[model samples]
Every structure is written in structure tokens, then in C-alpha cells.
Target: MKILLATDAYSVIVNGVITSIKNLRRELISMGHDVKILTLSSNRHSYIDYDSNVVYLGSYDISKIYPDARFSLSYTNPLIDSILTWKPDIIHTQSEFTTFSIARKIANKLDIPIIHTYHTLYEEYTHYFSPSERIGKYLAKKFTKRIYHKSTCMVVPTLKTYKVLKKYGIDENIYIVPTGLSMDKFSIKYPKEELELLKEELNLPLKSKILISVGRIGKEKNIEELINYLTKMKFKNIHLLIVGDGPYKNTLANLIKDYNLNNKITFTGLIPNDELNIYYQMADLFVSASTSETQGLTYIESLANGTPILCRDDECLEQTVINNYNGFRYNSFDEFSEKLKLILNNNGLYKNFVENAVISVNENFSSTTFANKILEIYEKYIK
Candidate 1:
């Protein structure tokens, strides 16, 4: 089977959507299926990289909202002819913007089914462009409903997302497919010397208990809550390592300075994807206060590396984190502080959580399993 994945976010933009799409493509190809990517050209000039199975459409940078994303101006891109010639059996879209509109056009032209995965909840991202929250949510809902109605089927990463769409009155057939990760990648052993070198390089305290969070440092992420909680903690050797960069970096840096907690928090602007697993492995625990995640891939990645998670309680994490079994979830700052102290101070409990973390990821979130589940969805519309 031939599959085409169309997304506005890809290549240079390193986000969960791109990660999920790449993993799905790799697994599908390994299973003897052909996959091609249709995305905006990262280069200033548009070109097609046939060897890489990618078609880059001409686009203008959209750095105001997303630093590395671009918006294609041409509704009828010149490369559409070449994509039509490839004759994909199905089109799976990962975004709701330019690439998605193109997906609909191509699907209508080729008379092929288009499957859409709602990755980001735009309502949570209103701060980027909308003048007011009310207007932003109303516009986001209208846009989501319009694009989703065109797809043959809708794929949501979690039941939480499904509920959101249903509440918006979208009566489409929605399938819950959690994004999968290459668990083996995280399990690979990094040399003890390399780990030590990384710690020294990042200036991470050797004796400190590392509490790391990986994702965009955005307002919607609610990272300020994590920083605030860190200040109130009674633990002395605890250090917060925020991994990733975003528009909210300056705001967070200012907040950190105002509280005079610079020593307690370290912001490692943006780490390369290849080296990210090492950070997760080096950490004693992974933590996230963000409530906007669809599936929280970083949580799964941390678990795969045998690091226990302590995250804000959200419905999306219900299937991933088993409280007390693998990790604990908290509803408020007080609850988070209590859980953090209990998990960090108790050596026996920490050991059990670490052991259960690995087991949970292997059994439920393997990339192979994710691809197989997606294949089931593809078959439903492929005819």
C-alpha cells in the first residue's frame, strides 16, 4: 500500500506531530508499504527530494506563532501534479492548515480517502494570535469542525481529545490511536563515561535529584507552575531541568530571576533529538505540569528509559501513568509537593516505580504496536 502523510509541521519543526509521523512512516515502510511525505520546504526555494520520499511546497515563514513552521501561499501547489502521479492509496493528514487543505484537494481530485489526526488542541493555543479567549475558542472550534468534516475518518491520540471533539458537536467517526515511540532507542545503554560527561557539560549537580521536563516552553505548557512549586519544596538537592525552547522562554527566565531561584532551575534551551534520550536516562524523575498534551509522548519516553514520571493529573495520562504503580499524578501544587517528597525521599518506592515504568511502556506504547493499530484504521478507509 502507498501512503501520503501531509502536514504543515515537519522537517525543521521538531514537535510530537513530526515525531509521530516519522515513526509511523518508518514502521509502515518496514512492513512493506510505501510512504511519502508532503510538507512545506524548509529551504527558501521549493524542491522535491525523491530519494527521501518528500515533496516540499513553496511557503512563507510563520515564525510569529511557531518558530520553524511555514505557510504555503499557493492553494494549488505546482507539486500537486507530481504527488497525484505517485497515486497514493490514502492520505493521512497531521495538521489542519495549508498541507491539510492541500490533502483535501488532492483527495477530492484522486477520489481517495483522507485520514486526519488532530494533534494539537488549538483552543489551548489562542494566546499566539487571537485577541481574546472567547473569540479564539469560537474560531478554533469552527475551523476544526470545518476541516474535520472533510476527512474520511478522524484519529485522535487520546480519549480526552475525542471528548473535546464530541463536545464541539463533530459527529465524525473518531478513532483513539495513541502515538507510539521506539522504546528500544531509549533502552540503549549510554556509556557511563558519556553520561558523566553530559552531566558535567550541562553543569548538572552530581548529588542533586534531577527533576526534568521536556517540551516547548510555552504559556500553554504552564511551566510557571512547576517553577513556583520548585521554590516551595523542602528538598535541598532537587534541581529542575527544563528541556526545549519556545516563545515563553524569556517570560520564564524573567520569572526565575524574580524568584531568585536561578540555582534551582536550569533551562537547556533546545537539545538535539538524538541526544535527548540521554538526558531522560540521567534524570531521577521526569515531571510535567502541562495539561494541554494530547498523549504526552515525553512521559512515555521517560518511562521507556526507566525514569518515573510525576505529572499534573490529566485525562490523557490516565492510560500511560498508573499512580503509585509507575508514577503519581497530582491535582494541585500542594498535592504535587506531597507526591514529589514521598517519591523522591523513599528509596524503595522509587525503585518500584522505575521498574514498573519500563514494563508499562514496553507492553503498551511500542512503535510497532502503534503502527499496527494505525494500519487497522487505514484498512477501514482504503477499501
Candidate 2:
């Protein structure tokens, strides 16, 4: 089957939606299916990354509203002509923005079914464009209803997001498909020497208990809460390693300074996707305070690497992070600190969490399983 994935975020912009698309594409191809991505190009001119099976449309930087993202221009004649010629069997959209509009156009013209995945909770992202929360939520609900109702089927990564769509009055057929990870990518054996060298280069202490969080350092991530919690605890041998970069880096850095946590926290900025597993392997635990994730991919990635997760409680994590099973979840900073201390101090209990982490991901979040589920949906819609 020739499947086309349309998304506003891709390539240079690394996020969960892009990661899900990439993993699904990879798995589909490996299973003898053809997959192509239609996304915004970082360059002023659009082009194709044939090797990666991507069709990039021309776009202008809109980082002021969303960091490292671009707003695609009107589709050019050549680009549209090229897509029409490719003759995709179905259109699966990962966003509700510019590229999604193009997906609807192409699907309509080609007489193909359109499927969409609701990835982010737009209501939580109003801070980027609107100053008023009431106005932002109203706009977000309207936008969601408008775009989602056009889809033949909607894919949501969690039941939480599915409920949100239903509440917005979108009567489309919604399927709950948890995002899958290529577990091997995190499970692959790395060169011990290289891993040690990276740790040394990053100035990570050889003896400290490392708690790492991997994602964009954005306001939505609630990274400040983690930093503040760390400062209050003031553990001498514990360090927090923040991976990934975003618009909020400067603000987070200043917050760290104000709390006098310069030595307790370290930021590695953006690391290449292929090399990200090394950092996960080096951590004793994976931690997050962000409530904005629709499906937290980092949580799965960490578990895949045998690293236990310590995250704030949220609806999206209910299926993945079980309290006192694979990992612990907290509702407040005090609870988070208490849980962290318990896990860090109790070696036997921590070992159980680490063991369960691997089992949980293996049984539930395999990339092959994810692709198969999505393929089933695609076949159902294909005539």
C-alpha cells in the first residue's frame, strides 16, 4: 500500500508526532509497504528527501509562535502535480495545520480516504499564540472541531485525547492507537568506550545518581518545577540532566541560577535521535513533570532502555506508568521528591522498577505492533 503521512512538524523539528511518524514509516517499509511523508521544509524552497521518503513543501519560519517550526506556503503547482502523480492510496495526517489542509485537498481530488491522528492537546498550548486563556481554549476547540470533523477516521494516542475530541463534539470515528517506539533503537548495544567518553565530555559525575528528562525545554514541559524540586531537596550526589533544546532554555537557565542549582542541573541541548539512547542508558531514572503530553514518547523510550520513570501523574500516562509497578507517579512536588528519595535509596525496589520497565515496553509498545495496528486501520478505509 502507498501511504502518505502529512504533518506540519518534521525533520529539523523533533517532537513526539514526528517521532511517531518516523517510526511508523520505518516499520511499514520494513513490512513491505510503501510510505511517504509530506511535511514542511526548513528551507525557503521545497524539495524531496528521496532517501528518507519525504516530500517537503516550501515554508517560512514561524519560530516566534512555535520554536523551530515553519508555516508552509500555498502549495506550488509542481508540488501538487507531483503528489497527484504519486497516487497515494490513503492520507494520514499528523497535524491540523497547513500541511493538513493540503492533505484534505489531495485526498478530495484523488478520492482517497483521509485519517488523522490527534497528537497534541491544543488547549494546553495556548500560551504560544494567545494571551487570554478563555479566548485560547475557545479558539482551540473551534479549530479542533473544524479539522477533525473532516477526517474519515481519527486516531488518538490515548483515551484521554479521545475523550477530549468527543467533548468537542467531533462525531468522527475515533480509534485509540497508542504511539509505538522502535524498541531496538534504544536496546541496541552501544560501544562502552563511546558511552563513557560522552559522559565525560558532558561532565556528568561518575558517581552521582543521574535523573534525566528528554524533551523540548519548553514552558509546557513544566521543567521549572523539576528544577525547583531539585533545589529544595539539595541532594549532594544527585544530578538532573535535561536533554533537548527549545525557546524556554534561557528562561529555564535563569531559573536554575536563581535557585543556585548550577551544579545540580545540566542541559545537553538537542542530541541526535540515533545517539539519544546513550543518554538514556546512562541514567538511573527518567523523570518528567510535564502534563501537556498526549502520549509521552520519552517515557516509553526510557522504559525500553531499562530506565524506570518518575513522572507527575497525568491521564496520558495512566496506561504506561503504573504507580509502584514499572514507575511511580506523583501529584505534587512534595510527592515527587518523596518518591524520588524512596526509589534512589531502596536499591532492591529500584531494581524491580527497572526490570518491570523492560517487560512493560516489550509487551505493549513494539514498533511492529504499532505499524500493524495502523495498517489495519488503513486497510479498513481503503476501497
Candidate 3:
């Protein structure tokens, strides 16, 4: 199966969707299936290589770090031409962005099958725009219906998203293909000495409880609320490690200053993939308040690294981090904070969560299984 994967957001910046695509492409290639990625170009196109087969559609004067505006609005001819020339067996488009429209155009032109994956649940994004929530939801449903309805099949990360699509009258073939980090990539057999060396190198205290949150540091993530809640807490030996860089970094920094939480939190902006597991291993607990995550990969990744996760009440999250069994979940900030304190105080109970979280990831969310499921879906549609 020769697959051409298209995405709007492709950069060195840490993104779950891009990461998952790369993993899937890697696995597919490993399985002896040809796969190519088509994406809009960032500056320094020479810095990265997608082999000869991977196509760069158009080189916009876009920076690696995109601003708040939607500048990459129009699809260029080069992209259209690339799709025509390659003539893939199937086109798998990600995100409900401008690029999916291009995929739709190519599919319509070539009369080939297009598999669209609904990565981000748009209704969550609507809250950031304004106070009036109804309009945002209206636009989200309208746009979701328009884009997803055209595809031969729509792939979503969770059953929650599948249900949402059903409500929008998108009765098209919807497959649940949850994305996962390659366990082999993080499957380093660190000797006890090496593990100790890593702990020393990161300056992680042996007894200090480390909490990690990795994802886009944006308003939609509700990171500010997490920071505020942490400030109010009275944990004696706790360190908060905030990973990834985004537009809201400075805003979060200011809030940290205002709340005088500078000492408690460490902003390690965009740690490389190689060192990510070190931080994950160091963390006793992982927490994210983001209601926007379709499937929180970091939560699973942390759990896979033997760390429990705490997240807000969402269907996808609930499935991953089973409350009181694996990790914890709460309805509101107050509720979340209460649970956080309990997890922090009860040292004996922490081991159960850590063990269960790893069990959950290994049993249900392995990348190998995810890749096979995706390939099965692709084969079904393409054949």
C-alpha cells in the first residue's frame, strides 16, 4: 500500500498529530509498504529531509513557530500537482484544517479514496474565541459535517469523538484508531547505573514528587488554571515540570510570577524526544487539565513510563486514566485540586496508580496494535 499522508501543521515543534503520523509512516515503511508525507514547507527546508519521496507542497514564508493568525489559508498549485504526480493508492489527511480541503480537492480530481482523521475536537477550541459559546459550537458542527462527510472513511482517536461525529449526522465509516508513541523508541534497557546517572544529570531529587504536563501551552489547554491551582496547594516537596513551548508561554510565565510560583514550576521549553523519557521516568505523576485533547498521548506515554496521570473529566481521558484505579480525574478545578492533594499525600497509594497506568498502556494502547488497526482500515477503504 502506497499511502500519501497530508497535514497542515508540520514542523520540528512537538505536536502529537505529526508525531503519530511519523510513527505510523515509520511502521508502515517497516512493514514494506510505501508511505510519503506531503506538507507545507517551513523556512530552512534544507534542515530536514523527507527522503526523495516525501513531498514539500509549497514554501510559504512561514516561520517554524506560527503566530496567532491563519496565514497558510490558501492551497498552492505545487501541492495539487504533487498529489496528481504521486497518484497514491490512498490519501490519509489529518486535522480539520485547510490542508484537508486540498486533500478533498485532489480526491475529487483523481477519483481516489480519501481517509480523513478527525484529530482535534473543534468545539473545545471555540471556547478560546469568545464568551458566547453557541456560535462557536454552530461553526464547529457545520465545518465538521462539511469536511468529514466527503471522505470515504473518517478516523478518530477515541470513541468519544466517534460519538460526536455520529451526532453531527456523519454516519460515514468511522474507525477508532488511537495514536500511540512507539514503545520500541522508548524501550531503552537502562542499567541501574545508567538510571541513577540520568537522575543525577536531571538534578531530580530522589524523594521529591515530580509532576509533568506535556502538550501545547495554550489557553485551550487550560494550563493557566492548572498553574493557579498549583499555586494554592501546599505540597512540601513537589516540582511541576511544564513541557512544550507555545503562544501562551509568556502569559503562563507572568501568571507564575503573579502567583509567586516561580520556584515550584520548571519550564523546560520543548525538550527533545531522546530526553523525554528521562523526564517521564523522573515524574511520579503526570497531569493535564486540557479538555481539548482528542486522545492525550502524553498521558499514555507517561503511564507507559510507569507514571500515573491526572486529567479533567472528559470521555477520552476517562477511558485512559480510570479514576481511583489507574490515575485520577475531576469535574472542576476545585475537584481536580482535591484529588491532586490526595495523590500527593498518600504515598502508599501512588504505586497502584503507577502500576495500573503502565498496565493500561501496555494492554490497550500499544503502537503496534494501533498501526495494525490503521492499516486494516486503510486496506478496507483503498481496496
Candidate 4:
């Protein structure tokens, strides 16, 4: 089967979506299928790999506009031309706004089946638009409903996300095909020796208890709140490691300075995918406070690397981390800090959580299982 994947936000820098598509392409190709990607190109193009034939449909100039809206245009003509030339058996689009809309149109014209993957809730981008969350959500949902209705099937990363979309009257045949971690590449590489070397390289103390947060540094990520909470807690021997960069990096750096946490927090801007497994293995614990994630890919990656996760008690986190089994969730920053302190203080509970985390993630969300399920879904519709 020849498959073409359309994405509104496609780049190696964006982490989850790129990694998911890359892994999916590898697996599909292994099973004797041809796969290609169609996506927008940002200015830097720093992160995109050159192996695959990725059709660049649009360009986003970061200096002129906000990041969220820059990739929102429905740049359909080039993609349509590509579709007519490629003539893929299946067109699987990863975003609703422009990529999915274009894919739906092309699929209809070519009489090919279309599959849409809802990577993130469009409502989450509301903070980028205006101050009014109510109006933002309304507009986002309205646009989403209009676009998604045209898809033959919609793929969701989690059941929780699926339920939310269903509530918004997105009644398409939704498939829960999650983003997965490469278990072979990442595992309980709790190499104390490697960690010691990494600590030295990163200029952190040997005794520092690393609390790693891996994701976008954006307003919707609630990173400022996490930084504020950390300041309030003021835990001893704790070091914060932020492993991604975005529009909010400068602001976050200022917040770290203002709070007098210069020694406590370090921003390791945009770690490479190959290096991420090591970082995951080196960290004492993984923490995510982002409520906007449709599926927390970092959490699964952390679990695969045998690191315990501490996340907010949200639908997405609850579904992935069995509370107290693989990881724990907190309702408030106070609770989260308390839990953090407890885990940092106690080695026994920490060890148990790490053990459980490896088992839980390997048993359920491994790439093999993810690929097989996705292949099954593709086979169902391709014919």
C-alpha cells in the first residue's frame, strides 16, 4: 500500500508527531508498504530528517506572527497537486485545520479513503488567540467540527481524548492508536556511571536530584505555574531540567531569574531524539504539568526508560499512569510538591514505581503493539 501522511505542524522539533510518523513509516515500510509525508516547512528546518520525501507545502515565518496561527492556513493547491501525482492508496492527515481539510478534499476527488489523526485538541490553542477562553473554545470547536466531519475516520491517541472529541459531536469512527516509544532504544539504562558523566557535562552537582520536564515551553503548557510552584516549595538539593524550547523560553528564563532559582533550574533547549533516551534514563524523575496534551508521549518515554512520572491528575495522565502503580497524579501544586518531596526522600517507593513503570509501559504501549494496531486499522480501510 502507498500511504501519504498530511500534517499541519510537521517537523522534527515538534517531538511527538514527528517521532510517531517516523516510527509508523518505518513499521509500515518493514511490512512492505510505501509511505510519504506532506507538511509545512518552518524557517530553520533544523530538525527535519532528509531520508523521506516530505513535500513542503507552506512556510512559517516566526518573526511575523504567533506560532500557533502561522501553520493554520489551508494551503491546499500544492498538496492537491502532490496527491494527484502520488496517487496514494490512503491519505492519513494529522491535523484538522489545513492539512486534514486539504487531504479530505483530495481523497474525495481521487476516491481514496481518508484517515484523520487528532493529535491535540484545537481548543488548547485558544490561549494563543485572545484572552477570552470561552470565545476561543467556541471558535476552535466550530472549525474543528466543520473539518473533522469530512474525514472517513479519526484517530485519537487516548480514550479520554476520544471522549472529549465525541462530546463535541465528532462522531466519526475513532481509532485509539497512541504514540509509542522505541523500547529497544530506551530502557532502564539507570547507568550511574553515565549519569555521573552527564551531570559533569551539564555542570550540575553530583548530588543533585534531577526533576526533568520534557515538552514545549509554551503558555498552554503551564510551565510558569510549575516554576512558581517550585519556587514556593524550595526543596533542597533539587535541580530543574527543562528539555524543550518554544516561544515561552525567554519568559521562563526570566521567571527563573526573578524567582532567584538560577542555580536550581537549567534549560537544555531542544535535546535530540537519540539523546532523549539517555536523559530519560539519567533523570531521577519525570514531571509533566501540561494539561493540553491529547496523549503525553514523554510520560510513556519516561516509563520506557524506567523513570517514574509525576503529572497532574488529568484524563490523559490517569489513562497512562495507574495512580501509585507506574506514577502518581496531584490535583494541586501543593499536593504535587508534597508527592515530589516524598518520592525524592524515599528510595524504596521510588524503586517500586520505576519497576512498575517499565512493566506497565512495555506491556501496553510498546511500538510493536502500536504499529500492529495501526497496520490493522490501515488494512481495514485500504481495501
Candidate 5:
């Protein structure tokens, strides 16, 4: 089948949604399917990368409204006429805003079905719009309903997001399809010398036990809560490595100084996606206090690299991070402190978790399986 995956976020931007799309596209191509992408160009000029099967529509920066966002001046892209000639079997939308409207327009022109994946829960990002939580959420719901109801079916990464859409009175068919990581990307064995050089460059002590968190540095991620909980713990040689950059970095940097956690924490601003696996491999544990994910690709990516997780309790992590299994979940700082000790203090248990972490990703989160599930949905919708 010829499938067209459309999104505003693509190769230039780094985040969970793009990660999921890259893996899906790679797997689908390997499975002998024709797949193409439609995304925004970084500048106000549109073009196509025939080699990568991507259509770049020109857009201007809209970061003031949302982080790393860009929107085209007009809904119609001049280059879109060429894509229409190709006539894809179906359109799969990875973003809800600009790309979504374009996808709907294309679907209408081609008379093909559109399947939208709900990658974000806008309710958690209320602060970007207004301080009033109730009003923000009300706006978020209205916006979500207006956007998603047009699609033939809606895809959510977890039941938590599914419940959110249902609560918003969205009547579209919703499927709980957890985003899959490309496991082979994390199975790499980097040279010891390279790792040592990275350690030196990042000012990481070779002997310290590393706790890494990988994602955008946004307020919604609640990274401050992790910093707060870590300060409360009376642990030894445990360093926190925050491995991404975003709007919240300045705020978090100030908070770190307030608590005097300079040596205890390190921020490696935006590591390249290809090199990200080594950070996970080098870490003793993957830690997160954020409950604001549709299904965090980092958690699965960490597990795929044989690193166990220590995260806050949420419906999203209910099945991925089982308590005392592959990882541990905490409801409070006290609970997080105890679990931190349990994982970091016990050598034998940590090894067991490392083993289970690899197994958990392989048994449940295979990218090929994810692609096949998506194909099934496309077949059902494609007339």
C-alpha cells in the first residue's frame, strides 16, 4: 500500500512524536511498502527530498504559541499539487494542527481516508495559553473535538489519552496503539574510549551512578519535581543527567542553583538522536517525574537499551513500568526515594531489572509489530 505520513514535526525537530514516526516509516519501508512524508520546511521556501520521500512545505516560526512550532502562511502549499498526482492509498496524520488541515484537504481531494494519531494531551500544556486551568482545559477540549472529529479514526498511544478524548466527547473511533521504538537503534556497543570522551566533555564522574531523563525540557514535563525529589534523597554518587533542551531550561537552571545541585546534576543539551542510545546504555537508571505523556518513547527506548526506569505513577506507565518488575513507579517523593534506594542500592536486583528491561521491550514493543498493527488499520479504512 502507498501510505502518506503527514506531520509538522519531522527530521529537524527532536521529540517523542517524530521518534515514533521515524521508526514507523523505517519499518514500513523495510516491510516492502511505499511510504512518503509531508512536513514543514524550516524556512519560507518549499521543496522535496526525493531520496527520503519527504515533501517540505514552507512555514514561518510560531514558537510564541507553541514550542518549536511552525505554520505555513496559507493552508495550501504550491508543491502539494505534485503530491496529489502521486495519489497515496491513505493519509496518516502525526500532528493535529497545520499538517492536519492539509491532510484533510488532501483526503477530500483524493477521496481517501485519514487516520490521525493523538500524540499529545493538550490539557497538560494549559500554561502556554493562560494561567486559568479550567478555562485552558475547556479550550483544549473544544479545540481537540473540532480537530479530531474530521478524521475517519483516531489513534492514541495509551488508554489514558483515549480516556481524555472520550471525556472530551470526541465520537471518532479511538484505538490505543502504543508507539513502538526501533529496538536495534539501542543495541549498539559504543567504544569505551568514545564513552570516556563523552563523560569528560559532559563533566560526568566516571564512577558516579547515572540517572538519565530524555525528552523536551518543557514545564509540562515536570522536571523540577525530579530535581526536588532527588535533593530530598540521601543517596551516594548518584548523578542526574537531563539530556534535552527546551523552553524550561532557564527556569530549571535557576531552580538548580536555588537548591545548590550543581555537581549533582548535568544538562547535556540536545544530544543527536543517533548518539542518544549511548546515554541510555551508560545510565544506571532512566528517571522521570512527568505524568504528561501520551506514551513516552524515552521509557521504551531506555528499556530497549537495557536500562531500567524509575518514574511517577500514571495510567500511561501502568503496563510498561511494572512495580518491582522491569522498573518501579512512585506516587510521592517519599515513595520515589524508597524505590531509588531499592534500584540503586541493590546490585543483584538492578541486574535483574536490566535483563527484564530488554525482555519487556522485545516481547511487547517491536517496531515491526507496531507497523503491522498500523497496516491493519489502514486496510480497514482504505476503500
Candidate 6:
């Protein structure tokens, strides 16, 4: 099988979409298939990596809309012509923006089915456009409905996202395919000596229980909600380590200062993809209050690392958080506090949750399973 993955997000962007694509590409290639990527250039200069099977279209910076956002004119290029010559068996789109437009053009020219994956719920990002969530969602629904109507089918990471698209009145086939993790990469263990060195470098208290949250620092992420709850809890021996960097970093730092909880929270900005497991391994638990995630890849990543998660209650986590089985979800600050205490204080329960966390991810979210499910979708449209 020859698959062309079209997206604006790629290697440079460290988010769930790119992570999912990387894992998908790896598994597909491992399964004896050819895969190529079409994405925007970091700057306004077209480039192609024939060795890696990727094309980076010339684009202009659109960071005013979102970080590292690049936009292309969707015009014909020699690189695009090469892709057309290759005659991909399937065009799987991971973004709905300029890249989707570009991919749709190829799909039209080559007469191949284009499959789109709903990675982010843009309806939750009203803060970026305006203060009106209702208006934002309304506009988002109309735009999404317009964009996705052209694709043969839509693939979503969770039923929550599937329901959202249905609410948008998109009648196209929507497949609920949970994003898969390359579980082995996350399961790596860092020796205690190296873990101690990491703690020392970050100035994290060596003896304190670590609660980590990994994602972009953005308003939509609802990170402040986590900080607010942490402020109220004031657990003496628990420290929050926020991993990753984004536009909202300064605001979060100031919030921590205003609450005088500087000692309780730490930020290690933009850790490389390969280094993620070390932090997860060092943490006793994973925590997040973000309701914006479609699949919450970090939840599975943490669980795969044998670290249980405590997250805000959302339909997206229906399968990720199994309450007392792997981790617990909270509907309110009181619930969050109570659950945090429960996980940290009970050694037996903590051990069981850790064990179950690995079991759940292995059973449901491995890269092989994700790739096979996706391959099934591709085969349905390829002919």
C-alpha cells in the first residue's frame, strides 16, 4: 500500500497530531507499506526530502492564529506533480486547513479517496477568536461541516469527537479510531541515578511526590484550572511538573507567583520527544484539567509508563480513565482533591492502578492495533 499523509503538523510541532502521524507512519512502513507526508515548510521556501518521503510546501507564517501555524496558497508545484506521478493509493488528511485543500486538489487530480482525521476540537478554542463559546462553536461547526463534506469519511479519536461532528450535521461516515501510541517507547525506564540528575537539573524536590502534566501551554488547554486546584489543595509533599512550552507560558508563571505557589509547581519547557519517558517515569502520577483533548494521548502515554492519571471528567476519557481500575476522573475541585489524596496515600491502590494502566493501554491502544484499524479504513477506500 502506498499512503500519502497530508497535514500542517509534522516533525517540528510536538503535539498529539504529529505524534499520532509519526506512530502511524512507523507502523505502516513496518507492515510493508509505502508512506509519504505532505506538509507546510517552516518558512516560505518549498522543500522535499525524498529519503524520508516528505514534501514541505512553501508557506507564510500564520502564528497570529496559532503557534507555528503556516499557510500555503494551494497552488500546483513540481513537488506536488511528483506526488501525483507516484499515484498514492490513499490520501489520508490529518489537518483541515491549507494542507487539506492541497491534499483535496491531489485527490481530485488523481481520483483517490481522501480520509480525514479529526484531531482537535476547534469548538473549544473560542478564546483564540472571541469570548463567545457559542458563536465560536457555531462558526466552527459550519466550517468543519463544509470542509469534511468532501472527504470520503472522517476518522475521530474518540466517540466524543464523533458525537461533535454528528452534532455539526455532518452525515459522512465517521469512524471512532482511538489514536494509538508507540507503547514501547513510553515504557522505557530511566535508572534512579539519571532520574535523580533530572530532578536536580529541574530543581524538583527529590523526595516529593511528582504530579506531571504534558502539553502545550494554551488557554484552551485549561491549564490554569489545574493550577487553581493545585493552589487550593496545598499538599505539602506533592509537586506539579508542567512539561512543554507554548503561548500561555508567561501567564501561567505569573499565576503561580500571584498564588505564592512557586515552590509547588515547576515548568520544563519543550522537552524533546525522546526525553518524554524520563519525566513520565520520574513522576508518581499524571494530572491534567484540560477538557479540550479529543483522545488525550498524554493520558495513555502516562499510563503506558506505569504512571496513573488524575484528570477532569470528560467524555473523551471514557476509555482512558477507568476510575478505580487505572486512574480516576473528577467533576469538580472537591472531587479532584479527594482523588489526588486517594491515589497518593494508598500504596496498595496505587500499585494496582499502575499495573492496570499498562494492561489497559497494551490491550487497546498499541501502534499495531491502531495501524491495522487504519489499514482497514484505507483498504475500504483504496479500490
Give the C-alpha miss distance for residue 193 in model 1, angstroms: 3.2
Which lDDT value does model 2 have at 36? 89
Q: List, in order, the clash count of every candidate structure.
A: 0, 0, 0, 0, 0, 0
lDDT at position 228, candidate 2: 83
Candidate 4 per-residue C-alpha lDDT over 1-383 given as tens digits, one digit per residue, 9 for 90 to 100? 88988886655564677778777777778778878877766642423344776776555554334564334353444445755787899988876555666677778778988887778776887877657999989987887777677877778898888887888997668888877766777734656898889888888777889989997788878878778888888778888889988888998898889888989988888887767888887788898778888888888888888889888888877767788787788889778988888887888999999899889887787777787888788789976
Candidate 6: residue pairs that collide: none
Query: Candidate 6's residue-wise lDDT over 1-383, tens digit each?
Result: 88999989786444888889999999999999989999988787888988998999989988888666789984788889999899998999999889899899999988889999989898988778656888988888887887788889999999898888888787568888988988778756789999899999999999999999898888878889988988788788999999998889999999999999889999988987777888998999999888899998888889998999999899999888999999999999999999999999999999999999999999999988999999999998887
| TM-scores of all candidate predictions against the true structure | 0.96, 0.96, 0.88, 0.91, 0.97, 0.97
Give the higher-lDDT candidate: 2 or 3.
2
Q: For residues 1-383, what per-residue lDDT tens digits would candidate 1 score against the true structure?
A: 99999988666333678789988998999999989998887655677888878888888888886655688876656678888888999999998888998989899989999999999888988877698999999988998898788889899999999999998998568998989998767758677788778878889888899999897778988999998888877568998999998888999999999999888889988876767889988899999888899998888888988899999999999989989999999999889988998998999999999999999998999899899999999998886
Evaluation by lDDT, superior candidate among 4 and 6? 6
Mark the 10 consecutive residues where model 5 has the least summed lDDT. Answer: 73-82
What's the residue-level lDDT of 360 in candidate 4? 87
Model 1, position 201: C-alpha lDDT score: 89
Residue-by-residue lDDT tens digits, candidate 2, 1-383? 99999988776344787789889989999989878889887777787888987888888988987666678766654776788899999999998888898999999999999999989888999998799988999989998888777889989999889888888886568899998998777758567687678778989887899999998878999998888888888789998999998989999999888887888889998887667788988888999999999999989988988889999999989989989988899998789888999999999999999899989999999889998999999999999
Q: What overall lDDT goes with each candidate model? A: 0.87, 0.87, 0.76, 0.78, 0.88, 0.89
Of the pair 1 and 6, which is ahead by lDDT? 6
> Which sections of candidate 3 miss by over 4 Å?
44-52, 61-83, 127-131, 189-207
Per-residue lDDT of candidate 5, residues 171-266 (tens digit): 567887888877777767777787777788889999988999998999988999999888887566889999999999999999999999999999
TM-score for predicted model 2 compared with the true structure:
0.96
- Residue 200, model 3: lDDT of 62
Which sections of candidate 5 miss by over 4 Å?
191-194, 234-236
**RMSD to the hidden true structure, all candidates:** 1.6, 1.5, 3.1, 2.8, 1.4, 1.3
Q: Which 10 successive residues of model 3 have the least lDDT summed?
A: 62-71
